[model samples]
Target: MPTTPLLSKYPEFGRARVYLFGLTAGCVTGVDFVASSMIGIAGAHIQGGVNAAPEEYLWAITVYAAAAVVANLVLGRIGTRITFRRYVLLSLLVFCTGALLCASANNISELVLARAVQGLGGGGLFAAARIIAQLVSEPNERLPIFVGFGLGSFTLTALAPWVSAELALSLGWRAIFLVQALVTVPLFAMVLTLFPRRREAPTTAQMGTLGWPAALAFGFGALLLLHGIEDFRLARIGLSGGETLALIVGAGLLAFALHWLHRHPDPWLDLRRLGSRRYLVGLGFYSLYYLISGGWNYLMPQFLQGGLGFNFQTTGMVLSLAGVVGLVGVMAHTFNFRRVFRRRRVIVIGFAVFAVAAALMSISAMPGASIAVLMPPMMLQSLTTALIMVQVASMTYLDFEPEDFVHAYQLKNIMREIATALGTGMTSQWLQTDRAIARNDLVGRINTFDLQTLAPELPRTSEVLARLSLQIDQQATLIACDHLFITLAGICIAAAGVVLYQRALA
Candidate 1:
């Protein structure tokens, strides 16, 4: 039997064992962020020239995200069997291997495959941290630790893109993934040494605990949600037959998945406790609220680049500022969530602020806009999202029975993963389509008559076409971005109402 420490040395962590556990948890968070950053850098570099189609390189992101969905949903049961520490080590190895593969890949397809491999392994990081943090800490003491994990995760994500970009630029794209492998290797070894071994428990549910239906729900739901968003966006530019099929398939799958959860006795989703009413509402609000939040986060960089025409450094600076403000918000809410503000109230306020911030952002994207116009929305939205996330961490578990901790945690985790993926995917897809449609519309409207053929009354058709294309690209981008604000605002409003209703119940 592994010896249990009498007391946690870190107090917050509970003992030497727990502190080491936290370090491992931190690695999990850090590594996942690193994987994402590496891929982002690779994608950015590949898409650097205008001649490259941004969509072609985006496979790196989509494939990784798909892997995360599949792994996150399936790995819960795996943890029951393998033990969290062993799982962490295995996940790290897989991630490192994928990084190495990505580093060596010569074409976009190879890079995407490598990214998928990394995502498959990297999926365990966040879920495992949630479980381990719970396992290592006293029930009352878990929030701060989880918050710390969240902070580390966000901070790494915040800084990583820039760091990876710089590394890729300096050493070439392959080096970005290589750097991830190098950094994680030493930490992985240290973590294995300090972490305690898992105790075998025969009674625990296996990986197939929820059965295939639940698994299908999770996997297909993610695909559907993501694809649905893609379709919606593509609709603006007029969908291709394939894209339209994808949209329909994705929505149908998601709806069926959710329906199965609701109706089936042993449902795919653990919908049993959703009867709590508070949990259901809270979780729902969380999904919708984060959907908007994810969209805003996804769109911010594009806004900076396409609308404001800022360089990477300036974009990083803006993102960094948002991250810092968000960090402060998280800290503020964590300390205040219990004593002063109730969970629902805090979430509602967060949504209200988000709505306002999103609205501000929409206005900032207007034609002939200045950089200063963006600051207010950027700062406010970031801070607002941070506060909501903190409150969500606390509120999600507020009503959870001690025995139901694993189930409750897993449920929320799934919701967040699906929500963010679907939300961001859809937002991006729509933005792309909208931009394309607007460009096409503008191009169609431009007078194309040859000057000589028009009785000397019109400009040369080719020159006019060139000027129109440039104007269309820029103006269309602005217009599409403006529409994102509407989506953001509507989501915020719906979330606010949900939060209010949940607060009343709470």
Candidate 2:
């Protein structure tokens, strides 16, 4: 069959074309962000809907990420082979079909399978969108474009939980899945109309050698690594109190995968050229950001609801407040930012501010603390999120050649997904362990003699004893969280220090 030649030279888009590209970019990123983030927010509801336990339901999220990583590897080739336009269209079809299946799922198995399918398509969509975004603008002009992208995506991220919760409560949990499916229809039409159709591949562009062996090895290695981490966290696969078997095995597999990618001719991922010191620094900062963001995200909800005894609705409201305030601040700062502050300075401040917020929360959180105490720090942390996001986006790929944009984009996002999971998993593991230890230490201090002194409202009775136990549990959880938040503050400081150390991000 005949097709147009591949785009050897990039076009300088006009004002209208720029706006069209921005719109498409927003839709492309927005759908994936909302759907993926919202699915996470509504996980408990979905779990209940499918009658799955916590561990079982988690596979839905895990599988989605793994599938996406695999999809990213494939799409970088497929986009060039089939033309980005056609590949994206087919990806959208796969995404919608998976969404529909997810909505109709009757069991955990069905839902997990659907999520994997959805992730495959979403991964392709994201890689293509990012590459398009990169190609459309020169490096010097990308900050504003990135700020624009961050505004919509982060705003949607902030809203996804509230929206998902509302939908689940009012329209049933299936509404979450339905939104993903329905939203793609208009997006499909928009992409078809707006995306350039002249970039069909010529015969010379084919990936003549399939890298399936290395690709599968990399994918499996990633899954094993994830499973190993999860197993260690759950205390399931450890032996002799040494490094866990799964982890050791996973590490070996990953080493082999990397070796293969390094040595294999026509490897699926030719990553040798992309690993400059500057690029590696960018990747490090990305992991730090994800760790902080994901860890806090996992912790804050529990702190609000469990530690402070706020209801689910109240927790959502507080989070929404933080999101809105952050969005407003980010928008105000975006236009005049270049004039007001240097990128390096802004990145430093972003991490520094998060450290401040974490420290504030570390000290202020208590069983009797009011929302006012939590709101300021939450808002501060949320506001800096956009700062780090915008700065990182504009700078991460500064060293990559135009030809490497597709692979570079995929690698960046792939690391981001992994770091996110690690952040949540590591925090959850520590919190649970610390909470139990705190609870035990607190329990050991309680006795009939100390009960009246600790709480004068309680009498020496079984019912009052139960109340005291509840109070102790609350106090213990808060103690664990307070300790954890302080540790996070130290990490944020280290993150800021790294930003200050790196000179290339500017």
Candidate 3:
């Protein structure tokens, strides 16, 4: 908990101090990696296997995301009322409690309730980290802090799958949550000992309260709308009458939530910041980047393990290689993002590489392909995402007021969370739908009656169709996945255009 001598004695630390600050940022990011990936375990647990319905399992992700959105909005306001140090420590406590609860959960529903608690903590960890970085450093020193946070997130993300797998195997998935709880203790202690508290605005009650009704309504509304969008895609392909009705209801709730937000005096989130040209453009790029990036995160595991049938270790190795490459790329650009690449140019180029990596992923799923053949493309993809993340976030707040940093940072996190939820959720659904349609279509064309009537004769049509079904399903899933990459690419390109327009305005 002791402050580095440099930070205590100097208003702005030197290079060593800055790097240490980055390391601190990374530690905070580690918390996020643990929380974010825990949901995957929750989903896997509920389905009782890896192959559980991707659509049904998606709520594990969406619910966590919904929690984050509420946290970002709510915590941003809460932080304004207290010291950054106190807020972070409190947030960590909430997170640790959630982790412990998740570890002890008896069922998926309990696990999700635990995750909602975890999400509250997880969301605060990210937003609070950004806010703390802003407070600790001078303007010129922020990039290093941002870099440190990025390195931490990417490293944990890269390592988490392998680590989670091991823990899940040896100790059960619950152990992952327990480990997070243990890790937070030292972090919590460090904050209390070192970080000095500061005065802030009035209490929440004095700041014109956002009541529970408005808060829950706003949260549920956003969740339902997002759920509707996710469910709509599934409904288009398959789903019974009940499922379709659920989707419609979700959409309606989302609409009502928006109307409520418009009418309410004390809505939980401040949507006014979203009106800024810079904030909008920045969020646009962030959402696009994550949409593309999230697709890779969600599908790559399936590509590595499900399609190629690589063992867990092998799949982890493949992703680990990409993560290492991404870390190197981020470190290489750490000192000078503005100097090395213009923001607009970096995003465009990054998206181009991401698209290429995504395309190669589809090819990697081709029958009989070795994963080693796909490593180069995956590394390139990781490198691109690494660069884009830091650059865009730093640029997003480039010209904003100091007071606006929390708002901008929270919005950035919200967009990334939602984009990941939507992208991963929708794509997983697409894969399932495509496979089902292919399987049913292949079955329909087979002459089961003729094969039965023929008795001992070779069931040529059935035999061919069985093999054909597997091939068609696999191929269709890959093709649909490939198209998603192209769609993400187009989204990124549009984001680039928005950033360019904002740049012109600047």
lDDT tens digits by residue: candidate 1, 242-318: 87787677677667666766675643235576456667766777677656766676677677767666766667666
Root-mean-square deviation of Cα positions for candidate 2 versus the true structure, in angstroms: 4.8
TM-scores of all predicted structures? 0.81, 0.86, 0.83
Q: Model 3 has how many clashing residue pairs?
A: 0
lDDT of each: 0.66, 0.73, 0.67
TM-score of 2: 0.86
Question: What lDDT score is found at residue 7 in candidate 3?
Answer: 40
Q: Give per-model CA RMSD.
A: 5.3, 4.8, 4.9
Decide which is better by TM-score, 1 or 3: 3
Q: How many angstroms is residue 144 displaced in model 2 relative to the true structure, after the best TM-score fit?
A: 7.7
Off by over 4 Å in 2: 1-17, 105-107, 137-148, 206-210, 234-245, 329-341, 449-470
Query: How big is the positional error of residue 472 in model 3, measured in Å on the Cα after superposition?
Result: 7.7
Residue-pair clash count for candidate 2 = 0
Which one wins on TM-score?
2
Better of 2 and 3 by TM-score: 2
Q: Judging by lDDT against the true structure, name the best candidate.
A: 2
lDDT of 3 at 312: 62
With candidate 1 superimposed using the best TM-score fit, by how many Å does residue 382's alpha carbon deviate from the native? 1.1
